[model samples]
Target: MARAVELATVLGSDRVDQALGLAATAGRFADDDLVSILEHIAASKPVGEIVRADEAHSVQSGTIVWQALGQQPTAARESTGD
Candidate 1:
């Protein structure tokens, strides 16, 4: 009970309440059972995933830059006319 209160100070009351309920349901009351269940619950929650837009724009590093790598500069090409 004291340990649960300590955890609640950091992890919040709602999450601790849920963990206690799960521990009771699973009949787990060992020294490390609550901690393990709380860790599992925290791990299962996603942090975040960044998703980028695929819209067409000049700012995007498209293949046009790669194609230009093998070509001469505009001034040099103009002199060669090739």
Candidate 2:
């Protein structure tokens, strides 16, 4: 919950609004349920894109989220035995 609040603070309303607009445009999510809309957006983006976006947009929040998610290793990391 704290991480969510931090991310919300970092992203602000404008960025969120823009993302929602984009989601609506790309996935016709305007009338969809929240879960369906989120699923559509997640399906549309590659994992790397999602990770990079989180890191680039809000490093601290991203770190918190990644940690909370158990900081799973990426494919490249596993391949290289990092």
Candidate 3:
């Protein structure tokens, strides 16, 4: 289609080709689907980025402590001899 050629001209064939493949796989065939997919592809940053505590925040305990959560809420509960 003429619009695909126009998009390819403006955005480059490789990007368009890749987006087209993704669109086909996702079953998106509406008129604006290409542009929508391209915009989503471009706007790749998560709408909200959550910085994990282990990433560099010194005040938060790191992930290793999280692994201990599976055992129970606390060892103190088990040690109570119930």
Candidate 4:
């Protein structure tokens, strides 16, 4: 829960929405759970310094937390073969 809030704080609404969708579609969580997380996100404000210092860390840690809660792996980005 705390992890999710921290994640939403750093990553903002769009990415958090994506995470929620992934979790829901994976059957890991229900609509109520997603709503609760979204509420937390809506109530949160990002601390600029903290966000700057640990955005990547927040995302990584949040990924682990979400996976533990049964979130599906996101689709890998296709390389352009550059």
Would you list the C-alpha lDDT of every candidate in the order shown? 0.84, 0.51, 0.79, 0.61
**3 versus 4: better TM-score goes to:** 3
How do the residues 1-82 of candidate 1 rate in per-residue lDDT, one tens digit apiece? 8899999999999888988999999999764998998898888855365555667534567676687877788998788876
| Cα lDDT over the full model 3 | 0.79
Q: After superposition, how far is residue 25 of candidate 1 from its true place, in Å?
A: 0.3
**Tens-place lDDT digits, model 4, residues 1-82:** 5666766787786867666876767675755666666666557675253444465555354454554465434452334334
Q: How many pairs of residues collide in model 4?
A: 0
> Per-residue lDDT tens digits of candidate 3, residues 1-82?
5777799999999878877888899998675998898788777765477766655667855578777765756677778877
Question: What TM-score does each of the candidates earn?
Answer: 0.52, 0.25, 0.53, 0.31
Provide the clashing-pair count of each candidate structure: 0, 0, 0, 0
Q: Worst ten-residue run, lDDT, model 1?
A: 45-54
Error of 2 at 8 (Å): 3.5
- Model 2 earns a TM-score of 0.25
Clashes by residue pair, model 2:
none
1 or 2, greater by lDDT? 1
Range of the 10 consecutive residues with the lowest summed lDDT in candidate 4: 72-81
Which stretches of candidate 1 lie above 4 Å from their native place?
Answer: 46-82
Best by lDDT: 1
